[model samples]
Target: MTKAQIGLIGLGTMGSNLALNIAEKGHAVAVYNRTASKTGAFFENAADLRERIVPCATLAEFVAQIRPPRPVVLMVQAGKAVDEQIAALREHLEAGDMIIDAGNANFRDTIRRFGELEGSGLTFVGMGVSGGEEGARHGPSIMVGGAQEAWRQIEPILTDIAARFQGEPCAAWLGEGGAGHFVKTIHNGIEYADMQMIAEIYGLLRDGAGLSAGEMATIFQRWNSGPLESYLVEITAEVLRASDGATGGPLVDAILDRAGQKGTGRWAAVEAQLMGIPATTIETAVAARSLSAERDLRLKAQGAYADALPTGRLVADEAFIRDLEHALLAAKLAAYAQGFAVMEEASTEFRWDLPLGTVARIWRAGCIIRSQFLSEIAAAYDQAREPAHLLLMPAFVDTMTMASPALRRVVARGVEAGLPVPALAAALTWFDAFRQGRGTANLIQGQRDFFGAHGFERVDAQGDHHGAWSK
Candidate 1:
């Protein structure tokens, strides 16, 4: 029998779906799972595609099923599990076989993995797969980072399995080393900010405006048809509109307020801080998640401050509702601008030469943050003279100018209504700082110079100068 074209380890949700996707695209795939029963079950469930799936129970059998110059995808857990699988696979694989880690791994770990695999006559690819299980079974956005030559070998299969925006595939070779995972981290960071901003808007409508869950659903549905249209907004409406079967109430009301995270958002914030980039909205979103986890403490604090808390409520009239929509759009733009900026700086820092436009284009379809807004970002980068920053682009400048007042009004009103809008507020503040010609950082520099003797850059002079603080 002819050997399989490629192999995948891990028969979990993501891996199984991706395997089926590859098979559907007409490639024979060899699949394996450490749990031998899972391998059997996956093969049994392949149905008509069974002919295209080579299910292997052992590492030796898995490696043997794929032809030489083989490319194998490992969709296992992000950390040590991945290391263990790679180690096991190395024992049975030949020199030229490539290992593609398709997990939400820290870029630092990915970089280290590259070092460990170097000079071993084996190729390694760190790929970021997004869009969740549904996208995996159908088409997810794929970001591949590895040797350009190794990328060429796996490009066809990835492109075939990736979601398409218009006629273009949402899969691309981003850069070398950990660039793909780094980009995915920023994607999740932006996703956290986007979700937090949406939740803030929901709180404003629910608490401030006294809207019912059904009413909020209608509003979100309406937004989905407009400029704010995206997968997340669409799902937000779906979630709000759902009913709890057990209680006959809004399903969302039954769900706990606490949100859980898998650390990608925190990694994004950490990397930004390390690079001295201002990802304020992302940072605020991560902080919000941590705060959300303190449910008991929050309850106690709320009770303690109940009497002193503001009782002001917002009037969700036609004009105010329109402002909310624009406000969301404006804040989302700022968050995305910050995410892309972080990616740009990371690209420079790692010497990855990441194709920023391709990143935006891929995100326009299969990723969690997929939006029409990303198309505008892709266009911004495609211009002959790409702006130094995303917000500096001429088109974005016009957008920000037009929508900023709405954002300001919404944030100010939400604050008065005692609504927590940290992500939105952070976006506004970041935008304000970005547009300012001269900021208040001079005082901070002076303070640092006074106490720590840290040098400050002089506006008038060419060199660093010290403030006369001894007196």
Candidate 2:
């Protein structure tokens, strides 16, 4: 029997689909899972694809079945489970063999794992696989980070199975160590912000404009044809248009108001804070999710403030709807700008030489945040060696200029209606601050100097000086 070209551990949703995708792409894959029953079940239903799968009952058998300098893919749970699997794999694997972790792990853990494997002669690839279950079964966007030699061996299979934008495969080697996972984290952060912005617009249309879910679905479908065309928007339209079979009503109306998260968005927000980059849009989105989780507190607060709260719809018109669309677009741009800015700072900090254009291009398909907007982002990054900021790009500059007024109008309207639009408000504030030559931070420095001995920098003179508040 021919030796399997690759080995896969964890026969869960992502791993099983990815393994099928790899096998379908004509690479013989060795499959193993913690539970032998799952492995048995997977191969039993493999159909014609079973010819390419080498099922192993033991880790030793799994490691032995792969060819020399083997590439093993792990799709286990993140954190302790990943570490445990690595330790087990290391016991059975030889030097120069590669272990590819295709999980939503924190980048710091990826970095540490890379360091841990340094002297062992084994290669570790911290890959970020996006596009969830269906993408895994068909094609997903893959970001790889590891030794170039190992990448060369893994590239063909990954590229063949990845979703394509135009003629280019939606997969690439981002950088070394943790870079791929870091990019993935930021991608999710941007997703959170995008969803939050969409939800805010939906709220405005639903509550203020008093439009039904079907009406909002139609609006989202229309938006998908324009600048806001994206996977999330497309899914939102589908979700809005879906019917509750039991209730015979729009499915969205019957769904819970609370939102759930899986930590990547919060990780991105925390990393942005640690890097001292002002990613307010992403921050606000994280905050929005956290706020959503406080359902009981919100219910109590609503009752407590019922008499004081303003109650009534704004009776929105065509003009308001148009402005809301532009507002959502503008806010989305700001959110993407912030996410990419976080990536820029992270790249510099980690010395990862990440190609922003390639990053944008890879995100154009297969990823949750895939959008027509990312195509424009790719163009912007391609236009320069390094852009000062995404918003500074000429095309983006024009778009923001044209759309910001509508954003301001939407935000103001939401505020007056007593509706919460935190993400939108944050994006507008971030844009305003980004464009400002001077800021109020000088006053903060003054307060700091008056309390402690913290000094402030002078705009006129080239020195940091502390003022004597007594004098």
- What's the distance in Å from true for residue 295, model 1? 0.6
Task: Report how far off residue 222 is in candidate 1 (Å).
Answer: 1.0
lDDT (Cα) of model 1: 0.93
Best by lDDT: 1
The segments of candidate 2 whose C-alpha lies over 4 angstroms from its true place after superposition are none
lDDT of 2 by residue, 1-471 (tens): 799999999999999999999999999999999999999999999999999999999999999999988999999999999999999998999988999999999999999999998899799999999999988988899988877777898999999999999989999999988999999999999999999999999999998888999998998898899888899999999999999999999999999999999999999999999999999999999999999999999999999998987675776688987898899999999999999999999989999988899999999888899999888888889887755799988899999999999999999989988889999999999999999998899999999989898999888899889897994
Clashing pairs in 1: none
TM-scores of all models?
0.98, 0.98
